[model samples]
Target: MSILSALTLSRRPATGFVIVGIFWGGFAAHVPVLKAQLGASDALFGLLLLGTAAGLVSSMWLAPRLDRTLGARGMQVAALALALAWLFPGHMSVQVLFFVSLIFVGGASGLLDVTMNARVSDLEAQTGRSLMNANHAIFSVAYAVAALISGVTREAGIPPGWVFTGFSVVTILLLPVLRMAPAAVEPEVGYAGAYPLWPILLSGLVVLVAFMSEATVEAWSALHVERTLGGGAVQGALGPTMLGITMAVGRFSGQVVAERLREVPVIVGASLLSACGVILAAVAPVPALAYIGFGIFGLGVSVVAPMGLALVGKLVAPHLRTEAISRAAVMGFSGFFFAPVFMGLVSELFGLRAAFGGVALLALCAVPLALALGRYPLRTAQIRP
Candidate 1:
């Protein structure tokens, strides 16, 4: 393909999707460290994450309407505000700063979540191909990079606040994309009605399971390794490295193969792959085996969320697809933000091993939802655009 064609393929939502993944992926890598540094208990951590998801859910309903009033760039600016606001949580005393910061972080992450999807919805309309998986692959790579950077920073004895602050500065890259993107014009004359909520909700449920599984790995794998498996902290941290690498590979390549498959079979195949991976990883006799398990798990789930998200991009009415996508995404976000806390609780209650088993179980949890999404593939789903 020519450079112009590649650029065209990547423009609009595809570009924003990558940036969105990179920024949030950084935030994701820090959860383990954040929990450790704050000395937060499991239930508290879950609640804090839930608060963030609450913010995202609220933004989902508001984003498309706001898009109508302000255009895509306007929505992007609102999201930018929230991303900046997330930095304060890291510096707070566990007693005071943590909860307050959690609220801000969740809200900001949530806002960005909705706005970016909205941007991608429009961009997909223009680009006319399945870009979601590739974009999420960008997120996986960024997530791995972010986790690695955080590991290095932790080694340097930097606190979470400083790490987040650095990311905040890096967030300035978002401004140019927001500025250069054109405003949404009126849609094709036939556009009408909001996206039916049930299908989107079901799709959201699918993501909720997949992301929850992912967050379980990202947030707690290190703890599981060091505390449960009797491994070094740094060595323990490699779970996400493996997961991210596998996810990136699967998703980047999955996007190509996904173009050849329909929604259901791909999701079913990927879900089964992830479910099996998690069971093997979680039950592995040793840490190395567990690492391999996580890699397989990553490959299994890597495609689930992006493919679901791509469905979101195609399903709803043009004006409302972003809103619909956000709604679906908030469910997944809730799953992600909530899963760590639940795992922490499981660790607190049973053991880290069993808690991880909970994560493994969700792979199966996702299968039903993925099948649900697949069942109704014709429910207004257009091609990726």
Candidate 2:
């Protein structure tokens, strides 16, 4: 491999996430097209989204076994299938094609979701460093670009024709990217025995709360700006944009610090910052402070998930690390998936501001979890699988 390609492959999690970012960006962009094609209600659109949630959950059931059998090569293949799945339905009716593609993308995403983290865990062994947060930050960058492209195209009056045509180009590009990954097990340096589930479950609980706050900001930050702070709705949309920008910056910097300051304090400090930001934003009588608060919260969450994943990666053995990751991932996914409903119920009872801002409380709760994680920080020598 060229030195550049080798350096690139060294960043396995980021490389894996490149494929993920493009699809996620494009699929979200494609949602309107699906709506146009299916003539479906917003309610039905939500139901269709359920398929993705189902696929994600379902993959957890099989991911452990798949990881055991196929290793990293299997993950590479899964990435390929995920990229290609978007290329389907060339000849089908729009509605049928929309649903089919969604299901395919969901399954493909689920597989990648489980396997890539496992590979990150594996790569950490070789490098003996905490790099997973940097990898995830790269994914966020890709998603930002994707979302930007989609929005620009729509605003420019470009037809959805560009969606398939452009995204197909990304798929073709990812094939070369996936083809060059390092093998998973040429030189396993740590234990490969069965992993204890208790720590993993604890990790999952932490992930769940972390994700709950993350999801809330993602979906409701703007609404909070408009409804509570009396901002123009257009101004409100900037919440996640600011959040994303700050978060991308924070995660990139945090990865550098992951080796220097240690993950535990970085995480606990981050959680506290996030919680404070949300609470400030929630109570702010003006839109500007709310935006500032969202920015801080985004920066805080930037490292928590990746740090959590790195911890899981560090604790387990090689063959079983993949399962350990997905186990935690499943719980986190459930938390994010259910957060919206919980918000809705809370909104009905209290108000959108109260319900939406409650996510700050989730971040506040993560403070102790972050500290507890320090008590059992994953040792570098023990990372495998």
Candidate 3:
């Protein structure tokens, strides 16, 4: 199927991806300023980020039921909640208030994340087309655009509050696109049976590793460029902007690749390539080299999580789709919030370079997990276009 067709089929979830991308891209670009405003040590900041983790865990438990309760309106509700939640953190100066704000941010984001991903899986099952990569590509595109805007705004001395507020308004403005037909209710009876654990676990691990690398870079690449490599604000912002651009290229490329290649080899090759990118960034002597590394890393890692989530959707029974995805997402999406903490602690104890080197090691760990996923007898008939 062509990209336009895939997007038309999956536009609702695609909007959710764009909303998430805009918020995070702006947040990533403004991290240095946000950190400075709070007067947080690296370790303390990492600890504070744990609030997001906590909220993520709670959202995972609540998402399936909430999705069921909200039905077709779930994405819109979650998006609005996320927009409201994001408004607080940028304005917060107190560490305690900032931490509390993150919990709400994480919870709202986690809800939207699970809802949109599961919606993509549902659309894929109904249409028998590869849509995840395409939808996620939209996210990367939005992220790159938002990061670039945030970079320019920061250089002009705009406060984080106004920046976040602008994005939130954009999010609210975009909500109409998320509307969809009411879902056919599945009986809740059979869903309580045991989900196949091994597939969920393995796929979740693959996503976890991919997002750990991604999260670390998104949260710290700017700092690495500025503090470690002695670049200025706009240059530091370029770090994530480069990553977002390359990731958009990679995921859009993957949408085409999925038509021709099996998922396993693609994932394994991407993992190895991402490992190289992270290692290069870790040892880079200057900001330009680090940007090259981040671009490479972004290209390789962009497809891993989407592919891993697709794997789970393919492997599980139809009745178990939402729950299995929520569980897998909880495991996978936690890495998004968790890696910042890991990066912060590592950067504190060692250095940003060393912390990024550790991310390289984490990227390599996905290889074996993908191999294990290949062992499962995927319902090949279901996934073919």
Candidate 4:
């Protein structure tokens, strides 16, 4: 294939990442509107958010089978499902209906997450390239862009329903773009067989820690700035904004080094830096210092999930890659599910500072796991190039 063809094929997965980022960024900006629409208190809103995690975790169980059966088509189908579900939440007036809508939305996100990663990993295996960090970097950049735009529109008094409608249209428009690339095929095996459970569990553990640390910052950093440091709303918003910008920069840097550096050192160094960042945030005397800490934290944690996923991709046999990734995603995303709740509970008991300290601890937990993953030799498979 020519260079143009390869570049086009590579872009398909990155486009999916951008769409996912748009949903999440817009969703974050719209949370206040949804709360007002439903008149939900803090506890009630947390429960409603929990439904998404429940749906996400539950749907992950089926994602592997879906991908296995449909191959690349599974990603397109899930993205469509996510896009359609995206529009429903904006229209929901009843609490029950809204809760149910989130379930569908989360389920689609879960499936799309697994399918897209599997597809990207397949593409990397086929091309002998390091694509995961670059794809994830695009995700971070899209997220930052969407959040900034949504913030502006929210300030202009735009209804979230209108914003969501735009997202739906864009998502649908991207379907043909997703279909531009040929489907990735599972590499042939001598006989159909099961993948070993250990690698999945180990890699999944690292992902869980990485995601939990990241989610803690995203969910609570603003609160930490406002409540703990007595900052104004503008200062509070800077918390996540700084983190997002630094995260994009970090992942972009990772894209350049991913192929050259071994996964272990990358993960180990990133985790340690993330741990120190959270610790600094936990101890910072002022909001400005906390912002710097969060920036450091974002920079450190940015490359972790991509590196872990790439390592898992390298470890598994090609034919079994989808299944292994599904298992790992289930573990990884559980952190996304529970991290905020965990932080909330800790904050309630000990205060937000201690809660952030707990996040730093979680980052440190990944260090040993990264070392273990380093010990596993990469398995070579015959794949298309």
Q: Per-prediction TM-score, please? A: 0.87, 0.79, 0.95, 0.89
Score each candidate by Cα lDDT. Answer: 0.68, 0.66, 0.89, 0.79
Candidate 4 stretches with Cα past 4 Å from truth are 1-9, 31-44, 90-96, 180-194, 230-234
Backbone clash tally (model 3): 0
**Of the candidates numbered 3 and 4, which has the greater lDDT value?**
3
Candidate ordering by lDDT (highest first): 3, 4, 1, 2
Q: Is candidate 1 or candidate 4 better by lDDT?
A: 4
lDDT for each residue of candidate 4 in 1-385, tens digit (9 for 90 to 100): 2323433657887788888888876775565567678887544665667767777888899988776676657768888999988888877778888889989988999988887887788788887877787777777777667656666676677777788888888999998766533344546656564665777888999889988888778766766787799975456656776777888888878877776788889999999999899899999989989989988998999999888888887888876777787888899988867785787678777888999999998998989998888777787755564
Clashes of each: 2, 2, 0, 0
Tens digit per residue, CA lDDT, model 2, 119-168 = 66667777675667777777666655664565566566665555656775
What clash count does candidate 4 reach?
0
**Which residues of candidate 1, in runs, are more than 4 Å off?**
1-8, 11-24, 27-29, 75-79, 180-195, 377-385
Positional deviation of 195 in candidate 1, in angstroms? 5.6
Clashing pairs in 4: none
lDDT of 3: 0.89
Model 2 residue 56 lDDT score = 67
List all candidate RMSDs to the true structure: 3.2, 4.8, 2.5, 3.1
Local accuracy of candidate 3 as per-residue lDDT tens digits, 171-193: 99999888754344244444464
